[model samples]
Target: MTRILRSQGFVTALGALVLALVAAIGYLVVFDPARKTVAYCAVMPDAVGLYPGNHVTALGIPIGTVNSVRPEGTGVRVDFEVQEDRALRGEVTATTVSDTLVADRDLAVLGEPGAAPWDRSTCITKTFTPKSISQTLQGFSQLAGQLTGGGNPGEQTRIRDSVVAFEAATSGTGPELNKLITDLGDALRAPDAAIGRIGGLLDSYSRLMSSIALNWDDIEIVLMQATEGIAFINELWSRVVQLIDSLLVILPWLNSIAREYGRPILGALDGALPGLRLLSANVAGLQQLVSMVPPIVQFFEEVIDPATGRPQLTYAAPKVALPRAEADRICAALNGLRPGHCDGAENGLSDVNLVSLVLGTVGAR
Candidate 1:
């Protein structure tokens, strides 16, 4: 029993010395400058689940931990650590995570360490609360109420009813969506039939156009012939028109010459009309007078001097002298005979045969 008591004392002393050495090591660790960090204050809307100890990271690297939390106003003030060796101008972030990588459980971590508040970087000591404690507590209270079937029982019943209705309404959406897709497919296919007909019509039109193109040179020759015919007709019309104009210009002069000649011709015919009429009337009178002149000439032939036995009227041989009484009578008869009548008588008084009588008459006269 004494040996057990001595062994117990020795074991107690060794344990105490081991504890003192650990304490000394912890003090030295706390005071060391290389492992030392700074204390900073962060303002957050809520504390989340930060406790006494949490890890702080600089750009996803663990640098330090959260120290404490205190209420400032409507928000919580957080005390965190940052290594002094690194330059830090902005505060760090604190969040409650389902799995914590901190030395103490359920503590906060620094969101980013290189963030600067005063150096124009977008670093803010702000927080976005996903699930607030107060909100969680309020949800718990509402769940408790609903479970007890007390206070706002009508709202709870309506909510349960609405969930059932929603599930029923959304359940047939799959079939409805399928029908919609079928109608859309029909609509999309409806235009293809018309497009096929259009393509056929266009092909026919192209064939017709090709046929016309194949005959283009013949058509051009026909057109050229028609054009030449039209040009020839136009030229002929121009020449005919010019000839008509020339005839028009000469017509007046021709008419004037005809008029000038026509006046003298008409005047001459007017004068000749009366002369011709008088001449026609006188022709019968002149014909009758010409017939009566022969009878008077025959009476003169009967009265030819009787052959005288005495020399008074002897025309033969101038032989006998005339008796006084007979000579006187014959001389008177000779004086009465007309010279133009005796000479113009066709049967008896030819000058060639009456030369002795013509000489005796001339000597007596």
Candidate 2:
């Protein structure tokens, strides 16, 4: 028994047993039964960041690993293994996508129902390679530089000035930017936000596309009507252009006329209004006064001499003398005084005592 125990062979067997126990423990702890059912898929070898042991995911869940990448035909063949629990089926597409901005990549499998299943024998006919983060950033930088006219020294100065201006404009926006980021985080963390929004957007886009497809004829009719309206607008614009040109030609003469007569015309216009208002106010009385003028003019025209065609005037004395008492009363009445109070009435106011008296004569010139 002592000899058996001291044998190096026994020690080796015991060491092997210890290793077997540890291996069994590890197997129990880490092994997944799902991974035992392996599947293969091919991808282009030149795809960026693709390597063995990179995860394969479907529906954003990790379900497989890249087994090997090797040359196959002119392109590359990527062998990948998927867990049994996550069925690798349908018209699946394995696309390489970045897990982070630092160039880490993974294979994303797109799966659908009612399609063929994939296994070790199945070949992935299509694969997509995404742009690396560095490349994307470089492209953005180039675009920004181009937009700022970056080329030589002068262009660089302009770019620097533009950057400085931009910085100045955005200097006060730190708080707003923080708030924006916080709001964005909250939005992204909301339940089903990204997926639901994308789904709704896709559904709306699909509806829009379908509507356009179905109503193309109506859309065409609308376009035709718009074209006709545009044509009419074009013609109206042409007429307006011609009218403006004609006005331009006449404008200098109109300006000269205005400069010469502007004050006089304005003064006349200002003065005429008051006279017009006065005429309006006395319109009825003036109409009555005007009615008497025609008759008086006609009478004067009849009294004119037929040969000389001139107006005449005459003065005559009374044919018989009034009684002395009657004459005194008539003189008092004519003098507008009491009957016996006229001093001149007693004198010879009618004292042409001769039986016939000569009177003054007036006639046409």
Q: By lDDT, who's the top model here?
A: 2
Prediction 1 global C-alpha lDDT: 0.64
Q: lDDT tens string, model 1, 1-365? A: 67875797888988999999999888888756457666666667776556666666554566667778788877877676667664355554555453533323343444344565323233235554456556779999988787656666556576678789999989969988899999889878898887889999999999999998999999889988998899999999999999999999889877887788878878889999998898667768866757757886765554564475332332443322344545545444544553331222233222222344556666743
> What lDDT, from 0 to 1, does candidate 2 have?
0.74
lDDT of 1 at 215: 99
In candidate 2, list every pair of residues with a backbone clash: 43-78
The residue-by-residue lDDT of candidate 2 on 1-365, one tens digit each, is: 99999999999999999999999888877765435756777756355677888888887878888888777887678888777767766777778877576665788888776566765576887777766667789999999888667766666677668889999999999999999999999987886888898999999999999999999999999998998899999999999999999999899888998899989999999999999888667777877769878999988887897789888765443443445667766555634532222234343344332212221212211
Q: What TM-score would candidate 1 get against the native?
A: 0.31
